[model samples]
Target chain A: MKVAVVKYNAGNVQSVIYALQRLGVNPLHTEDQQEIRTADKVIFPGQGEASSAMDYLRSKGLDQVLTSLTQPFLGICIGLQLMCRHSEEGDTDCLGIFDLEVKRFKVHQHGFKVPHMGWNRLETDNSQLFQAVENPFMYYVHSYYAEVGIETTGITDYILPFSGALQKDNYYAVQAHPEKSSDAGQTILTNFLNI
Target chain B: MLTKRIIPCLDIKNGRTVKGINFVSLVDAGDPVEQAAIYSDAGADELVFLDITATLENRKTLVELVRKVASKINIPFTVGGGISQKEHVSELLNAGADKVSVNSAAVRDPQLIDRLAASFGSQCIVVAIDSRYIEGHDIVHTHGGSRPTELETMAWAQEVERRGAGEILLTSMDHDGTKKGFACDLTRKMSTTLTIPVIASGGGGSAAHFEEVFNGGKADAALAASIFHFHEVDIMDLKKELQAANIPMRI
Candidate 1:
């Protein structure tokens, strides 16, 4: 399958490429609109702060490019948050593909860490990504979370229940790094690839 | 209701996983890619690969190695070592690294933290602080614990967060690889003070050690190397213990 990974100043693009490679797909990494438009599946992956990452995306006109994608698009971590309507990190404006807001977890009474790093159980009734995995735990490393809404396909809890994964028609976004997660992580990618 | 995270870090040199006590007296741990898969099966929360070599040969081969691991495993993986620039961070992230850690670089140019966080987004930037107990002062270590900086660990952590660091991987040089236990006081002090989540690294000998880091240290996550590599403790078993301890864990 031909996969197009959106390239920006953020991290985790190569890991997504490698993940595709294991599935026998050496996906092309590019910021080119034509290439991205023509690809079978497009993945927008990132690791970085929100506002500036979005700034780069806008500077490159990638924000517009991403918003125009018709094929199935998967956004990872920051990519997923950027796909939302807004974010609390750096007061960033994001692509409004999914009608969700990315908000920071406020300091709570439990005294839990804010970033919510490491592996957490993924609870979802949607079998598309969780197929054969049976609610497996996936790797995560983030401070901000996408507020739960209609498009949420998976849910994980930190200080509260947040959008671990969101799917709205052709656009699919996951706050977790499927490239970094294990078999269940691969399954989500495989499912997205198939979609 | 988030499941507590258990991380296993592997120090990679020339693509091989190596372990040492007190960050010295190195020994072979295993193949990094293989170990990563093992950790995946055992339900590790995430894996961290620190390219400690900083060598031409190792650096050249490390990206490809990371690609190999990312392709096979479904979990998130973070890479550290020799990262300083935006392009380097871009390259590593593009190479399948979920996050790229900035240590010495962040210390040298604090703006580099802002640059990276602004470029990649704070979620992608990690400020790894190696710290030690100064008789009366809280100090941060640099150059992989070979040099000391005047920056206080807690103060630096606050600055790191302000500078746009998404998270802090706090490793205690005094406790690292000591296998005695985590620096509870240090971790608690930072955990309580910093707004961001802290991954406590160093001095984990058993499942109990993980508990100490989580409960006593109040760490969001606990990271270790040798204990996991040598099978001194199993990831699933450890998580089970943590779960039984009434600490929420992903089973």
Candidate 2:
């Protein structure tokens, strides 16, 4: 299976590439339209500011390419956020693959940090993404989270219940870093690969 | 519930993992890549690689080592020591480091935190503060705790967080290598003070010490070296104890 990770001025793709390699697949890390479009699976993993990432993606004309790709495209972290209608990070408009709006985590108290950074359990996962695994631990490091809605395939509680994973048609994305996540994360990647 | 993170910090000197007693008397632990793999497989939440001798000449070598370990392990790895410039941060992040920790650089140029946070996003910039109590006040130290600065530890931590650092990797120079336990009291203060995650580093002797840091220290993460490096404490066993003690862990 040909796997290609979307690369731009967004975030780090090395861990995602390494994760795929451990699964015995040497995936291509590229921003090339043809390479990304032609790949059997395209993993869009990003970890930077949403507006800046969108600017880079639009500048490289990847915005259209990403939205149009019919194959299984997995968006991680900011990738998942960018797939929404808009983000509060920079008040920037996004790809709108899913009719979603990304909001910052509601820090309830003083020590309630913006970025919910650490390992947290995944609850209520019925998608193929959670295949071979029950509610498990996944590493999350982000301030913005997708609100649970119709497209929410999984729900997680941090400051409040939010979409842990979103699925709409061929577009699949998760707020957690499945690559940085341990064994269960690898299983999610494996399941995506099988998809 | 946030799972308390157990991070194994590897002090690197001349491209080799070394452990120090009270920030001095360096001893070789093993190869960086090999030790990193062992920790990752042993269920360490995150791994920290600090170049003890972070000279300009050896920095390139550290990035190379980071790539080697990042390719092998599937967990978040933070690299620090002698990271001064934006380019150094980019080099480490490009080399597969999930986060780039800056200590003296951030203290010297406070705006460095803003620049890094702006450029790479606040999620990847970690401001490491090596501190020791001098007289009656906690003072921040630089260059591996050899020099004490006028900046107060808590004050500096607050400044760094306000300047947009993702997390504070706070190491208590006073309690480091003591093997007695972590500085839980101050750690709890820092954790309560900062809205961001405070990784309590130093003076981890056993699982009980970790428990104290998590409960009293209220630290989001705890990093230790000698105990884990010399096999005095195993990561899996430590997690078992922490789990049994009602500390939420990834066990």
Candidate 3:
């Protein structure tokens, strides 16, 4: 399978490469429009500030290229935040693939941390992603979460039932890091590949 | 609820796993690549590999080791020891490290933290503090815990957070290999003082010790090496015990 990992001014794409390699596929990491356009599966994984990333994307004109793709695309972490309508992170607008607004996790909530790091299970029932996957805990590392909306496929509760995974048409994005999330996370990747 | 993380740290020297008692008397433990895969499958939330290599050739060997380990494990991986610049971090990240920790260098040049956070984002930069409590005060020590810096522990943590560090890997030199327990007081102080996650490292002996650090220490995550490296404690069993104690663990 021809897989193209979207390359941008984001951190931690090496883990994505390792994730794909474990599944017996060596994906091509690229920023070229043609390489991303002609892939069987595209993964938009990132770990960085949304505002600066959006700036880089606009500079390289990847925003249009990402939104125009028809292939099965997966967005992870900052990638999901950037696919929304707008983010409160830096008052920056996103690609609008999913009509949802991203909000920061509220502070002063007793003793809980802000970034919501580490692993948590998915209280979701989507067969396409969770099929045959018994344990559903996946790694998450973010301060902002997309509010659960109509197209929400996976839901997790930190302060509220936020959208852990969103699916609309050909675009599917997850707030969790499947690459670093162990066995169940790999299963989610396999399910996406099968689709 | 966010689950508490149990991380097993590997002290690597020249591509081999080594262990020590209170930072001395190094002994060969096993293969790092094999140990990493075993820990991941056995339910370790994350893994840290501290490259204690001295020569440039050994540093190159560590990179190859990281590549081999990343290909097998499916969890968060953090690499530390002798990381001095943004270029070193980039090389490790390019070799499949999820996070790169800067210790002595960060203490020597505090501006290195800002530069790394700017280039790789705060989420990618981790400021590791090796601290020793003495004279009724906690003092920060760098240079493999042999030298003391003028900075205090709490003040350094505040500064690291202010300079945009994603996390702080706080290792208590006094309690590191003693395995009595984590420095609960220090861990709680740092966790409450900082907005970012605090990974409590050193002096993890038993499952109850993990409980003490997570509950009394208020640590976001607890890390240990000796107990995990010698099979004295299993990660799964430790999680079960912590879960039964009403601590939220990723089981």
Candidate 4:
């Protein structure tokens, strides 16, 4: 299967590429519009600030290319946040694929970390991305979370319940890093590839 | 709910695992990549590879090792030990390290944290503090905890947080290698005081110790090297025990 991982100013896309490689799929890490559009599956993995990422995407014309893709597209971490309508990080506007707003996690209570790092369980709906994965623990490291909405397919509670996975039509986004989430994560990636 | 993490730290020297790993299943225990995969498969939440190589030439080998580990292992791993510059961090991250940790360099030039956090978001930058309690003071130590600094542990931790560090890897010199237990009081203090997660390192000897660190220490995560490397504690059993103890675990 041809998987094109969207390349931008984001960090950690290499890990996603490695994950795909481990699954026996040689994914193309590219910023070229044609390559991304032509791939069987497009994976948008991110690990950086939203505004700068959006700016890079806009500069490369990938913002438009990404929104127009019809194939099964998956977004991870910052990719998921950027898929939202807006993000409080740098007060940046996103691709508006999910029509949801990403809000920074605000917790004054003890034991509630801002980044929400490490392993957390996912309460998934019947989304194809989480086919075999039921409330399994996945790795999460983010300070902002997309508010749960109608399109929300997975919910995870840290400080409060937020969208862990979102599925709107062909676009699937997860706030956690599936590449780094071990077995359950590999299953999710395999599901995405098979789709 | 986010479960407590169990991290197995691997000491690297010139692209190979330094200490002898007693995993019977590993084809080459010295091979960092092989060791990493075993740990990941055995249910380690994350892995930290500390490169203790001294020469500049050997440091380049660390990046290559990171790339190989990233390609093979499915879990997130952080690379540390002698990472002092933004360029070094960029190389390691580009090679697919999930996070890069700064220790003595961060203590020397605190602005390095700000610069790194500015370039690459705070989520990827970990500030590892090696501290020792002396005369009713938790003093920060540098150069592998052999050298001491005037900076207080709590004050330095708070400063790192304010300067935009994502996580703090606190290794208590007092408790490290003792196998007695983690410095629960100090870890709890750091965990409660800081808004970011605190990874308690140093004195994890048994699964019960892990349970204590998570529940009593209030640590978000706990890291150990010898117990895991020497086959004294199994990650799966540890997680299960932690879960049975009402400490949230992935298993």
Candidate 5:
């Protein structure tokens, strides 16, 4: 099975590459439209601002290409947010793969911090990503979260309950970093690769 | 929903992973690449690689190790130690590091902080403050907690933020590895004072420790090394506890 990680100006591609290698899969990392379209599975991964990332995708026409993919595709971190309806970061319109808007964490009156980084537990997953694990913890490092109801497969709280993972049609996106999530993360990737 | 995160900190000396207790055990953990793989598989939310050897001979190798590790993990990783210039920050970011953290370098030459923030943008630059409570003051430490600088932690933090630091990794030299609990008082103050993200490092002994940091300190995130490495606390369990405590976590 072939997996293609969509490449752009975003960082965190290296970690995704390493993650696929460990799973005994040598996936292609590229921004080329044809390669991404032909892969058995595709992963849209990134670590950076939303507006600039969208610009890169739009420049290469990858945004339209990603929105049209028929195969199972996964979005991680910023990738997941980019699949949402819109983002507060850089105030960009996302791919709208999922009817969700990514909003910045509102700082609580008592002074809650943003960029909810670290590992938190996942609960109630029915998707392929949780094939072997039941409500396992995953690694996450993000300040913005998607506000999608029902499509959410996993949820974590910082200031309030936020979407952790979302599923729509053949597209799946997780705000958490599954590649860095250890066994549980690996399990999710393996499941995605297999699907 | 907020997810729980488990992180492993790798102290690098001459491109090798080193671990010390109370910041003094000084044992080789393993090859950084291999250990990083181990931690990532064991379910580390993120990994922190701090270059410990201050010698010039080791700085070059540390950068290469970061490149190697970045090529292997599929997670958000932060690299610290001997990072003082925009060139150093660029090299690491170009090497695939998502974030570059600077400590003593930022304190010594605050301009370097502004330069990096301008070149790479503030989101990619993280300022690590190693603080020690000295006579009711949060004194910034340099050279691996061996020396004290004239900079105050709170004051320097604000300065870095103004200069465009995306986040601050605050480690309490007094509470680190001691596991008594985080410097909740200090973390709470910084989180309240700063608008950027605050990662509370040091003194996490149990799952409750994480809850305490989040509830009492109001920290955005709590980073621990020994507790997770030694199996004293499980990441999922910790998240459950945090969730139970009504702290928003991913579940």
Candidate 6:
């Protein structure tokens, strides 16, 4: 399969590319609209600020290209947040693919840490992306999360219950890093590839 | 629920592991990439590679090692040691390291934390604090805990957090290498004081020490080098023990 990873000014795209290579798929890492549009699948993976990332996307005209794509697209971490309607980080607007708002974790108590940085179990629905995975734990490192909504397919509890995985038609997004999530995450990526 | 993390730290010198590791599955124990893969497959939540390469020429080797490890290992890993500049962090992150830990450099220039956090998001910035209790005070130390600093341990940790550090890696010099146990009191103080997750490093001898650090120390995660490198405590077996003790582990 010809997979195109939407690249911008974000970090950790190399790891995504490596993960796909481990799965026997050499994904093309590109921000070019034509390459991304023509690919069989597109993976939007990143780790960076929302406003700066949105700015880069607009500068490259990827925002429009990404929103208009009809192929199966996967968004990871910041990619998932940027796919939402808005983000609390930098108070920037995002692509309205999921129709959800990304809110920062409020540390009301002492034990509740921001950037919920560790492994957490997922409460998943019947989404095809989670076909064989059963409430598996995934690696998470983020302060802001997409609030659980209609597109929500998986929920993970930290300070509050947030959307772990979201699916709406062809657009699929996950708040955690599936590339670094070990076996269960590899399964999710494989499922996405097969889709 | 967010589970407690078990991190196996590897010290690297010129792109090779410094300490000898006794993993039967590993062909070359000095290979950080192979060791990291073993840890990941054995249920380690994350891995940390502290590049101790002294010469500037060997720095390229660290980046290459990071690239190799990121390609081979599936779990998240952090690359630390002598990382002071934004350019250095940019290179390592571009090479595919999930997080980068800053130690003595962060202590030298406090604003470095802010600059790094602004340039690269806070999620990738980890401030490693090495402290030793001296005359009823927890004082921060630099250069592998050999040089003493004026900053207090708790105060420095809080400062880094306020300056936008995503996490704190606290290492107690007194407990380290003792093999008695982790500094539960100091770790608990940092964990309760800061809103960021604390990874307690130092004296981790047995699985019970991990349970103590997680429950009593209130550390979000625990890191150890010798005990893991020497095979005194197996990662999987240690995690099972922690799980049996009602401590949440990946296993």
- Chain A TM-scores of all predicted models: 0.95, 0.96, 0.97, 0.97, 0.96, 0.98
Residue pair clashes in candidate 3: none
Query: Which scores greater on TM-score, model 1 or model 5?
Result: 1
Query: Residue B198, candidate 5: how far off, in angstroms?
Result: 3.8
Error of 4 at B240 (Å): 1.1
Best by DockQ: 4
* Model 6 spans with C-alpha error above 4 angstroms: none
lDDT: which is higher, 2 or 3? Answer: 2
TM-score of chain B, candidates 1 onward in order = 0.93, 0.94, 0.94, 0.99, 0.89, 0.98
Ranking by lDDT: 6, 4, 2, 3, 1, 5
Model 6 C-alpha lDDT per residue in residues B40-63, reported as the tens digit of each score: 888889999998764578779999
| Weakest ten-residue segment in model 6 chain B by summed lDDT | B51-60
Least well predicted 10-residue stretch by lDDT in candidate 5 chain B = B20-29
lDDT per residue (tens digit) for residues A10-117 in model 3: 886888898898899999999989999999999999998888989998898899999999999999999999999999989989999989999999876767767788
Q: Which runs of model 3 end up more than 4 angstroms from their true locations?
A: B20-29
Local accuracy of candidate 5 as per-residue lDDT tens digits, B77-170: 8888888777777777777687889988887788888888767767778899999989978999988888998888999899999998888899
Q: Of 4 and 5, which scores higher on lDDT? A: 4
Q: Which digits, one per residue and each the tens of the lDDT, describe model 5 over residues A1-195?
A: 878999898764777877788889899988889999999999998788899999999999998999999999999999999999899998999898888889998877455545566667666466677789754777777789898587888787668888888888889888878876766788898898878
Write candidate 6's Cα lDDT for A126-187 as tens digits.
Answer: 67899898539999999899999999999999988999999888999999999999999999
CA RMSD, predictions in order: 4.1, 3.0, 3.0, 1.2, 4.3, 1.2
CA displacement after TM-score superposition, residue A152 of candidate 2 (Å): 1.2
The DockQ for candidate 3, computed on C-alphas, is 0.74
Evaluate model 1 with DockQ and give the value.
0.57
Q: Is candidate 3 or candidate 6 better by TM-score?
A: 6
lDDT of 4 by residue, A1-195 (tens): 789999998876888988999999999989999999999999999888899999999999999999999999999999999999999999999999999999999986666889889888889976678888753889999999999999999999989999999998999999999998888899999999998
Q: Write the per-residue lDDT of candidate 1 for residues B116-224, one digit (tens) a residue.
A: 8766767678889998888888788889988899899888999999998977899988888789998888888888887777889989998888888888889888898
DockQ in order:
0.57, 0.71, 0.74, 0.85, 0.37, 0.83
For candidate 3 chain B, the 10 contiguous residues with the lowest summed lDDT are B20-29
Q: Model 4 residue B121 lDDT?
A: 88
